[model samples]
Target: MANESVTLRQIARKVGVSVGTVSRALAGENGVSDRRAHAIQDLAKQMGYRPQPLRRQRAGAIAVLVGTSESGHPDEDWSQRLIVLATRASAELSWHVHLEFVSRNDDSRRAVAVPTVVRENRVDGVLLAGDPHSSIIEYLHRHEIPMAMVGGRAEKTGCVCVNPDREQAVRTAIHRLFELGHRCFGVVLSDRRYPSTEAFYQNCRQSLADHGIELSPRQVLENLQPNLGGGVIAARRYLAAGEPLPTAMLFTNDWMALGAMMTLLEAGFRVPRDVSIIGQDNLPWCNQMEPALCSMDNREERMVREALVWLRRRIEGSPCEPHDVTVHSELVWRGSCGPAPRGSAPNGAGPNGAGVTSPAPAKSRQADPSSISLASPPGAS
Candidate 1:
């Protein structure tokens, strides 16, 4: 008889255990005790028994759950990018990707509904692309569904997460600005509450403190949206405060940074001349702007790859320790940032020609925006 054709029932008969126990042991399921599972697996391997391939076990479909805003509108830019990356990665693994959008309102009573894929049992695993509500995550956990969170956190739900290293990104941005002769810094933040945003704020504060810098309350702008209109409001508020402006500013993302730049230019503040600014996401328009925006490039490809690997393991019934995976962010240098303005510093220079001490100049290079795909679906903003 062929060794690969050895049956689990034959192994169970030899091991004096039920066929179900032997099957769980060979499949790496948790029903069987560790001692019995190991013994059965060893005997099966000795007998040259081969478990069935994963492809034959079930349908090869994965679901991606995207969340809509409180107003029930989809965020095309972020969501589209996430979906594109996920689809690209899934293709390599021979898995189909399906997108499901969950819209929620302010009322907690009306929670986010379960995804249709889960209801229909069409997908083997799920990838959460955004902040789908806690209730949704809880439902998945209760049902014992294999799921991983991408670009978001689900620690409370015990779901593995793959996201950008926001703390490291903030530190890199601050260090780069410091080397460029910027001391005082301002930060623009969106009002939306998410784990990554919270991580950004905490890391920014810690990084500034590490440099013996104090982040003043006036320097932090919060509760603003993450759009062009929010950027306009932030600029107006900063200008009307009548307080001394920081030499460097960091916007949470590119859209708000572009909006703030436009508003500042209209008000006669020359970008990187009067003030240096940086943004995150390294979007396509970063290079098209008159003064190209310097931003952080969040490695979406790597994030997707890691998330898919974890999800694949879960779907294949492979034993994997749940852990968070974080992809580092790279600083994409462009034309937006420059040396701080003369005489704008509160303290005189320490023989460095400015208020802040400048370190030895490091080699800098401009990033090729063409290297990254910024294309979106038709009508996508």
Candidate 2:
């Protein structure tokens, strides 16, 4: 009997208990006395009665909370990608995935006012899909909830965060543009409050400084929305600024870049002809545009996978230090960017020598000018 087909029935027979009692004991379920459960579990272990994988215990479903816009709609492109990837990963792990949308503009104090899922205790953990307020994060910590952040850093709160290397991605963009002979540069950003947005701005400024170039205050266009309308507004501002526009402009994301591209075309400023442009988040539509958008590929799939892994570890009661996982981005060169416009100074030209005149002092630290590094792109002399 010990050598032949070890089963719960065999264990029950050996322990003088019913199969139900054996099952409950092996599963650590209540109803069986602690002493009896321990004895049955030990007997099953000794009798080589292995539990089937299909009956393995699970930590329950995870909740993915995404931030919605002012209109109460989540960013479809970003939110969808994260949900799909997380769902797929959860399926493989035999865990369920539940998605919840929260407003980006919600007051931090109000955001944690007992979400229905939390009150019902439906999920074992949470994956914050975007930059939620620190207050909400702190609330989760106080409740002893297992949580991980995606697409934003949460180092202060000791949450494991998975994000694209924004600084390095911006640096790569600058280097690529420099290689293409673009010295003078500009950027269009929205939502200064977002950590990701601030990172992009700071990194872009720092990268230019490292290349011996100055990012003038006028070069940055801010206070716009994150959508196409924002792009249109930014375009209007750029056109109104008059002559000597920076030869290369970087949009915070693809939507704005495409929107601005349409506006630029309508204004008779031929893209890559009058002013080259680059965007981030290499969205699918980028390639279909009149001129394919040159942007950074943020590797959304990898970002989600990393976030889920950390979340699963937390759910399993694994001990891990707070970690910041950075997935590097790739530069997707497209027709949107080209060599600097004619008469523009070459790549190594200083701010004064470039076609762009240095604007007034920057009000923010990101605008501070610094000396250029001797670093050259790979294979450059």
Candidate 3:
């Protein structure tokens, strides 16, 4: 039997399981337990049960349609990461990722090209990677093209979306800062030029309020773009405003956080001493910084792979349930935050020999003021 060709039905019968279970186990379905699925796959391999290759359908290739031009937002690393992940995922699915890069310079070709690509059946489904404008999303919805968003939940349509729950991420960051004895809070937000981009900015406000951290209107600044330069400009303006500087200033993304660090160091502020800063999207560079960045890891690659799996299930016309998958982000702590000023911890954090043993609650903070400051004296590391 090991050398002989065997049908799936035979494998199912021999294994004493349903054909459907054997098929799903082969295809890696969600409901199939890993132990049973792996057993089925192993037994099938032992029996030399090779699946027959089905005819490739039009839905096999999923095109990833990006709304923004690479040139338009050069500093945003998230977009490039998403595209690379999507491409890799396509290869895993035995499908091609057709990138329909809509050039911003050619504004007129925008609406026409995407719909044309869909109608022509060039790909089985579409993955909208970047900030999709309302018009493009509307067109995708109108055409009934099987699609999903690689960003946040789609505002206009019910297309499948994969995103890190930003609200949870933001709340976690604030909770950590508060544990570290941070009272005043400041947030740098992305400008609301596109609809989907508003998710980060809006969620920050809600998270702060929920965490009991009240920030004045003047403390929150919105940069025109979501990039390094925007962060530098916003951080500079916030520091110069002369109002009591926030103990910690949270940024929208890692690139911005790096930029903010540069500005703060230039102004002679020691991190976690004079000001604690937190950023979202823990890109590779986050760890390379001198103090190392305290940021949230979005887990983009995993999210992309999961999104492809969902889109594939939908395209295959399988009884795949429609759902939103939100990946959780964990806080990556570093030298950026210091122990709160003396006597800040309400519960009196436990003491471990290496450092203070704070309960790794969903969020952690240090209450002592002597241990932390908002500004380090000039020329001090």
Best by TM-score: 1
Name the weakest run of 10 consecutive residues (lDDT summed) in model 3.
352-361
Give the Å error, residue 357, model 1.
17
Candidate 3 deviant stretches above 4 angstroms: 1-56, 69-75, 103-112, 193-203, 319-323, 340-381
Candidate 1 minimal-lDDT segment of 10 residues: 354-363
lDDT of 3 at 87: 89
| TM-score list, all predictions | 0.73, 0.73, 0.67
User: Could you tell me which residue pairs clash in candidate 2?
Assistant: 212-372
RMSD in Å for all candidates: 12.2, 14.2, 16.9
Considering TM-score, where higher is better, how would the candidates rank from best to worst?
1, 2, 3
lDDT of 2 by residue, 247-309 (tens): 788887887887787776666566776678888889877776656788898888888888888
Question: What TM-score does model 2 achieve against the real structure?
Answer: 0.73
Candidate 1 lDDT over 257-296, as tens digits, reads: 8778777766656677767888888987788666788998
At residue 37, candidate 3 shows an lDDT of: 73
